[model samples]
Target: MESRNPVIRRYADFQKPGSVLGNNQGRYDGNVITSTPVDETTQTFPGRTPAKPGERVVTMDDVVMKSFAMLALLLVGAFVGWNAPGLAIIAAIAGLVLGLVNTFKKNVSPVLVVAYALLQGVFVGGISYIYQNLVVADGTNIVGNTIMCTMVAFGTMLFLFKSGIIKVDAKFTRMMMVAMVSYLVIAVISIIASFMGVGGGWGFYGVGGIGILLALFGVGLASFSLMLDFQSIRQAISMGLPEKESWRLAFGLTVTLVWLYLEMLRLFAILAGRRE
Candidate 1:
């Protein structure tokens, strides 16, 4: 299945046919199916010892635990960033660079992923502070509201996806890709406009009804991106990927959740700004 997630799509190990993952099915790009049938009796994968009796494989529990671990690290970083708000821009830039590295790295490094979580947390925390203190109206509780919204969105999407209410097929993937690309272009332009003092320094996202619409669109995009992450993790588990691959899956989920949170934060901030 084609995935728009940069983290999932960049995994070359999953695509390898006769490689460590065994003679599995086709890769993520939907090409190069291995002719050799998988041996049911024997299980072996790279980056770890051979599957022993009662040895663990990649499971939902593993992914969830790793995700929580990363989230903990992120929260710690966020605390530091919240205390020292001046590190916001620097953390954002560093987080972006680390994110790109983690995304493109052939082998998953738990250390690097953990580092990313912390740095990303700092960026997120700094931004949240700015929105709550300087951007939103007094007593708006923008951060609290945004966090609640993000959690709700995540739960809603997971329920919809697992209950078959949402199906991530090729058609759906294509549509999402198009929408994501278009949104990215619009976001870039809006940022530039904001820098140039347009839309009262809020860019296209502050132009009355249009700005509200754009913020809603952003929230929607981030929300739907969760579905993609869910689908990818489900596929990875079904494929019997290595246990270590859980880090990569967790990283992808963290990335999506962070994006969603940021989107919600911005939406709340924009609405609060309008009210003020």
Candidate 2:
């Protein structure tokens, strides 16, 4: 399986022949007809009707449910963090560490994934509160606008992916990877320059015509990342991954969505700042 998404690539390592769709053997009784014993083959498992064999394989519904559960926990954490923005720095650090741990570990731990989601929610909520305070006073609901835009982008990407309009091929995946690396390099440089007091307000990000462009690029990147995620989930389902892997899928999606939301928030902040 060719996938640019790191989570999918990692999970794909676990797949084996017959691991996805196991072979079915008919039930045999002691009765013999001629030289061979009589065997009963049924479409459903014993005591279960209408449900085909291997029906318990992973499904989109499982991924969606797991994703929703994680989101719900994140919302709860966000509510708590929004009321206490001072903890944003700590939450951000913790979230980053947890994210790295979850990403590198071979076996998925539901507890750790949930913990990471909660920490991310805290970081998001705290930063959102800060951004709202800074930009909302200008009579613009930056946070609300960002949320709406993120949802719109997500829906658009999902539609495009599911409709087969945006195919995930090796070439496309390579291009996306290159673009992401370039963007990350720029971001790192900007952060360093900001710390050194170079380029003032937005550092390299705020240079003439750069700030808005970077923001647009970031939004686009995050949206495309979501598409990669969709492809990963679709592939996982088609390959009949175990249901337990749903947590990994959910974690990956949550991470991308949070990235999208943050980028949207930053874009709006820049615009609001310019307006003021």
Per-residue lDDT over 45-64 for candidate 1, one digit per residue giving the tens place of the 0 to 100 score: 33433223333457788899
Candidate 2 Cα lDDT to native: 0.72
- Candidate 2: list runs displaced more than 4 Å: 1-5, 8-56, 135-137
TM-scores for the candidates: 0.84, 0.81
Across 1-276, the per-residue lDDT of candidate 2 in tens digits comes to 233345544433323222222234222121111222212211111111112244455577889999999999888888878999888899999998988888767667999999998998999999999989954468789988988998899999999998999887656666766777788888888898888776564667666568889988999998998876787676556444456667888998998899899999988988887777
Candidate 1 runs further than 4 Å off: 1-4, 8-56
- The collision pairs in model 2 are none
Summing lDDT over every window of 10 consecutive residues in candidate 2, give the lowest-scoring window.
41-50
Per model, how many backbone clashes are there? 0, 0
Give lDDT per model, in order: 0.75, 0.72
